[model samples]
Target: MKLETLSVRIGRDVEPMAGDVAPAIHMSTTFERDSDGEFSRGYSYARADNPGRKALEQCIAALEGGHDATAYSSGSAASLAVFSLLRPGDHVVAPIESYHGTAKQLRDIIGPMGVQYTFVDMTRADAVRAALTPATKLVWIETPSNPMLNVSDIEAITALSHERGAIVCCDNTFATPVWQRPLRFGVDLVMHSSTKYFGGHSDVMGGAIVTREGGTLSERLRDYQGTAGNTPAAFDCWLLRRSLTTLVCRVRAQTENAARIAEFLSTHQGIERVFYPGLASHRGHDIARKQMQGGFGAMLSFCVRGGREEAFAVAGKMKYFTRATSLGGVESLVEHRASIEGPHTVTPQNLLRLSVGLEHADDLIADLDQALASRS
Candidate 1:
């Protein structure tokens, strides 16, 4: 089935008894036991299993073309679950230009646990290959990387990782399944902050990991999820499942809006540079063209003509885009990348990240024009 059709159809079965089109949100923490002392319904507890989470996991797995999926309370938990599978003395390779939270997890949390990691420029396949040690068991890829919009060649990275006997996992949060499917490029796992596009709104928070094929790795993920007890609540799962019906439509629209906005900023005098893969001048445009389908993506970032203060002035004057953290929502958002990342941030002081939304391209452009206009 086409992605759009699948998005709406995946979990839309009518309730057998209620005769309702919308699937019922299974909220019971525990299920009934059979006379034989077995949980024949296939669910003994909410932490172990829930109908809502199962439906969500099934929907995301199908969408990503994966064999199975595990849902988590947040994207961090989903990522941590992957790291948990590795033992002490294991090594991981991750992108230097990635979400700060992921870096923090590696440096402060995972590293101290005795699992070492090396942060390299994932945009360069050779760099990644050189960084891998015999102990490396995982290669993490975050294409269209957070704040920077850097794109990595998934097929190349996956090949290198597999050659080294390392599992490759790509964070598909920025590039939703609608545009890119990492599993298609031989990535072992695909991860998402379903809290972003999957939820389609700021109302819900959740995460998910979809495996290319079920085996020892997938089984371990399931065990860790149940034992950690950090799976999404029943309502969050239901909300995310309902939101999936519109995933394709919403992401495409937001992508179009972003392309237009990127174009406008690229030529504007107040902009030092626009970081969008859709632009031909962008460093990763060719790789993105080869990998992404439908459109580039909804997220873009640009540098102000001056420094941090100038960027702050531009953000302050914005009339439409909200100055906020987080992305992948219906409402446009603007954020000063470095300020939010704190003192250790490698992000350029002049860079401002924008999360384009479902708003009309023209209105968003005009608002940006006025915001960047001369104040004298």
Candidate 2:
């Protein structure tokens, strides 16, 4: 079935108790056992499994074409689950510029735990290949990386990791399954901060990891999830499941808006550079063209003519684009990413990241135009 069909139909098979089309949310913390003291339904406890979470996991697995998926309370929890698979003295390779939270986890949290990691420019596959060693257990790829919007070649990196006996995990938050399916590129695992695109409305917070083959790594993550107990609430799972129904439509609309905004920024005198894979001028245009399916993506970033002060001024001048953190929502958001990422950030002081939303392209452009003009 097509992604559109799968998004809406995959989890709708539940037998609604009241003849309602919407799937019911099982809010009970625990399920009853049979009179013989044996488990009857597939579920025994909410922490171990819940109907809503199971439906969401099934939906995400079907969408990404993965063998199975594990849902988490937050995207960070999902990252931690994957990192927990690595033992002391194990090595990992990741992009130099990625979601700050994930990078921090690898560098600060996991690094001190005895696991080693190397951060390299993943856009250059040679850099990644050079960073790998016999000790390397995983290669983390985040195409169209956060803030910078640097697109990495997933297939190239995956092949290199496979040659070295390292599992490859792709962070697919920026490029949702509607745009790019990393599992199709032979990535061993695909991860997402479902709080962003999957949640769509910015109300739900969740994370997920889908395994292509469901091997030992998948088993480990499942075990860690159950034991650690960092699982999404039943209502959050239900909300995420509901959001999937319109994932394709929402992302496509945002993609179109982003393209228009990027084009506008490219020609504007106040802008120094635009980071959008959809733009022909982007360094990753050709590779993105090959990997991404329907659209480039809604996320983009640009450097204003001056430095931090000028960038903050521009962000402050926006009328429609809310000055906030987080992305992949119906409403547009603009952020001075450097400030948001704090003192440890590598994002340029002059750069502002934009999360193009479902707003009309012209209105968003006008808001940007006014902001840029005010800066001049």
Cα TM-score per model: 0.99, 0.98
Candidate 2 structure, TM-score to reference: 0.98
Q: Which tens-of-lDDT digit does each residue in 1-376 have in candidate 2? A: 9999999999778574677688988899999999889887888899999988999999999999999999999999999889998999999999999999999998789999999999999999999989999999999999989989999999999999999999999999999999999999999999999999999998989999999986787788888889999999999999999999999999999999999999999999999999999999999999999999958999999999999999988988899999988999999999988887866688999999999899899999999999999655
lDDT of 1 by residue, 1-376 (tens): 9899889888777888979898898989999999999998899999999988998998999999999999999999999999998899999999988899888899889999999999999999999999999999999999999999999999999999999999999999999999999999999999999989999888999999999998998999999999999999999999999999999999999999999999999999888899999999999999999999858999999999989999999999998899998899999999998987765588999999999999899999999999999721
Looking at candidate 2, what is the lDDT of residue 115? 98
Residue ranges of candidate 2 with Cα displaced over 4 Å:
14-16
For model 1 the local lDDT of residue 134 reads 95
Model 1 compared with the native: what TM-score? 0.99
